[model samples]
Target: MLDKTLRNFDIPAFQQDLINWYQANKRDLPWRRTQDPYKIWVSEIMLQQTKVDTVVPYFQQFIEKYPTPYALAEADEQDVLKSWEGLGYYSRARNLQTAVREVVADYGGKVPDSPAALGSLKGVGPYTKGAILSIAYDQPQPAVDGNVMRVFARVLNIDEDIAKPSTKKLFEKIAAELISTADPSSFNQGVMELGALVCTPKTPSCMLCPVQEHCRAFADGLEQELPVKTKGKKQKTTTYAALLIKNEQNQYMIEKRAENGLLANLWQFPMAPIDEIGMEHITNWFFAEYGVQMNIGDKAGTLKHVFSHLIWQLEIFHAMTMQTETADERIIFVKPEDLRLYPFPVSHQKMLKYILD
Candidate 1:
């Protein structure tokens, strides 16, 4: 099927047109300014499930702080999480740091140039590996991410469900074969850029597409229907109660999450499940965990945060601490202003806003 699909279009012309259009019209992103493997690696990791516009400032700030693999590897985990505060996917930051540490320890603090070496690092999957190789090293590798998949599906008029692993493999194969050996970097970026700006998911700008003449979906008037994807499983909603405990000096109590779970190593107001036992159970759990007695007060506010796999319905509660001395190392009491130094998940961040406001 892939061979037959290639036969229907002029491959050379398609590549040339796409590359020309990209070089002429590509967005002036910060990452595009340099072929530095470390910078490109950072940008690519941050770009996963995140928009380019949103990533720009984060990328700039992050690179300024941790300019090299050695810097990132040497930074504290909490500091790293703080640097990645609003980026949402905290694990990406953690995993990238871990991988960078490996690079420093084993690969001489340089991001590996070859595909195989880059791929062996933690969190460096196929797309990231290909991106690092093609964009940084100018290797003829295919980075078939969602945007690329969308572009290829429309260009080839493929109707396979993109959510399936098999579909991703097919797209990767097609991209590898189609990649321009002389300039894979621009070609891959062009494909993604075209998908992002012109061949949008809802309403593609067919007339403005550079490769429209060779696009199978354009010829068939089926651009919108070509990149088929199955719907994901429904996200489970879990109810939690976030406690804002104030000490005698008006300091708020916060706790760091366990090192190996969702939102790991991030700070948050002490929280407990809002189960059948209700606020009483939450209070009990808080006291048990932190060794601090709490006098629960009026409800402050409610905040909802949605992750990729679950929805958190957080109910905020104001409370006064009955005991100041708690031996738990994970728990800390700090003035409200001090909270700025810690990284809290968006849910807790919203609750903090209500407390401060």
Candidate 2:
């Protein structure tokens, strides 16, 4: 009997309820004012696995720097990453840069209106493409983000594992059915807003929920159970060694990372895996490679940064060095005051801040 109630759901009343709520309570976000695909694309990309408040400043700064797809394509990748500092998931920043290049070279710097064409661009995955089409172009496309998934699972009282790809397809079909063709952009925003503010993950404000009457989860007192999820794999941990070398003039030595891997193209103190490393080996490597000698200082502290799949346990050590020979190596010695000029990851920022204070 409960199972049957979960099936054969109707969405018109729910849609109306959400639309009404959004008309009055929607946030005055900058991205909501314009229908520009480029702005929409940038916001959606930045919003992935990130909160709205965190993304607002980044969006403003990125737009001020890039302004358009052609501008972003022509700018340096490091500059793009620099603007995206403090935002996790470095790949999204890289992909945004790559997508800009593709948009300029292939699509003449305009985002595609059709879903298939939008999806063809680099980093414009299904969810992103749907968002752009529906929100910017007013197309009746299904943007099935985590928020919408939660809303649909509870409204229909679905217990089918929401983690499955099939569940996404099912939700997409249902969303497309509920979307008001008269104003798809409004309808899409309404549903997304409902999920974000009303049907939140914990202690949902059901009193304010627009469609509480039609929600099967509300009736059965199973709002938390309807959107069933499978447990995800635990994050893997990795160790890092940072060599905090200081020169005779009280300046620190730092290097720019290659434009790949974690925290790509950012500046940081020299680092190597410490499990198979020793102080003697580091001293030898610096002298042989860069012709610099150093007296190892005491261990300053350790910092940890967590990414989606990997965890970094960074062990930072302080050392003093004097240059024996002047060579134009890839390393730069900068005073603490000038550290802000170069872009660095949050982990490195924290380390520098700690040492400075």
Candidate 3:
């Protein structure tokens, strides 16, 4: 039944068209060459919610620094976070490190080839597992990314709101059935490439499309109308941070963020919620938490940071402590030289320089 449906679908022509186009047009991405599941895994994770050009240098630098799972596992969290700086979604970096540790401990530092095993790794989701299994292990798994979603919707003339879960399942089922039986890597890359290059979300270059003839949307003159997406909820804006920095005797007082919030487990200058950052609020928080008296100094500056759902308008303050502090409770003072050994988000780092300079 599947074969019959595919026969009437011009599968060969579309496959050949995409394959020929890919042979001549696919970009020379480093991850495309090796069947190393580790390399492919890293690339796919970095590529999520990120662009290819951004992932390239990061991938190259990361692989150069930590060439193996064992190496990545042995790396300090600070070093790992530093490497992942500027690539937001800091949690992904933390999860990647956790996953490396798991791979080293359970799999003996060799990345698993099976989809089930790969999917079991920390931070390895359905799309990532599919990408690794197919691109690295030659498994006929369909990696459904946004590009693939768009391509499948247009190619099949699907209009059941691509945002719907049922629509996604239908696309995945069709993708698995249509997957090339040979060299799944090439086939997967061909689909991803066609979607990214020719059948883009907006202003698709249909005149240059390889499988335009097989595209039901193109045949119906609805290529621009397919893959209907429902509007998403507005990203709520909330502000909750104002970084505070204290520089004394070449040391900066920095605090480790809680392990669950944005940029968790990363170092930052002592920060309080926006509502708790005035002169009175800072003094009250310090007295309540540490029983220490502090003389609030000049306002160094404010740093504005944006997350996917929240915005932080941080007003940094400089201050001097009443006594030499020990690294005991919430805040710790570290020399500027030692500060380099810790990973601080850019927002905190910006405030640190304001005081250190």
Best by TM-score: 1
Model 2 agreement with the true structure over 1-357: per-residue lDDT tens digits: 433543566656666777788899999997987777898999999998788899999999998888888888999877787888898788798898888888888888888787777898778887888889989988988888888889888887777788898888888877777787877787888878888888998888888888899888999999867688897898988787777888878788888777678777788887766555664587776666556678778888988988778788888888888752347456788988888878888888888865588
**TM-score-based ranking:** 1, 3, 2
Best candidate, lDDT-wise? 1
Tens-digit lDDT string for candidate 3 (1-357): 335445578766677777788889999998877777788888888999998988999999999998888888999887888898777788888899899899999989888887778889889987888888888888889888778889878887777788888777777777897777776677788898988889998989999998888988899999889789998665654444353434456566677778887888787776556464554576778656555556677777766777677667777666666454754465777776677677778776676576557
Q: How many residue pairs clash in each candidate at the backbone level?
A: 0, 0, 0
All candidates' lDDT scores?
0.89, 0.81, 0.78
Candidate 2, clashing residue pairs? none
Candidate 1 on 1-357: residue-level lDDT in tens?
888878857878989999999999999999999988999999999999899999999999999999888899999988999989989879899999999999999889888887778999888999999998999999999998999999989988889899999889999999988999989999999999998999998889999999999888989999978789889999999888888999898899989889988999999998788865576577677777778898889989888888889998888889998565689999889888889899988778877786678
Clashing pairs in 1: none
Between candidates 1 and 2, name the one with more favorable TM-score: 1
TM-score of each: 0.97, 0.89, 0.90
**Residue ranges of candidate 1 with Cα displaced over 4 Å:** none
TM-score of 1: 0.97
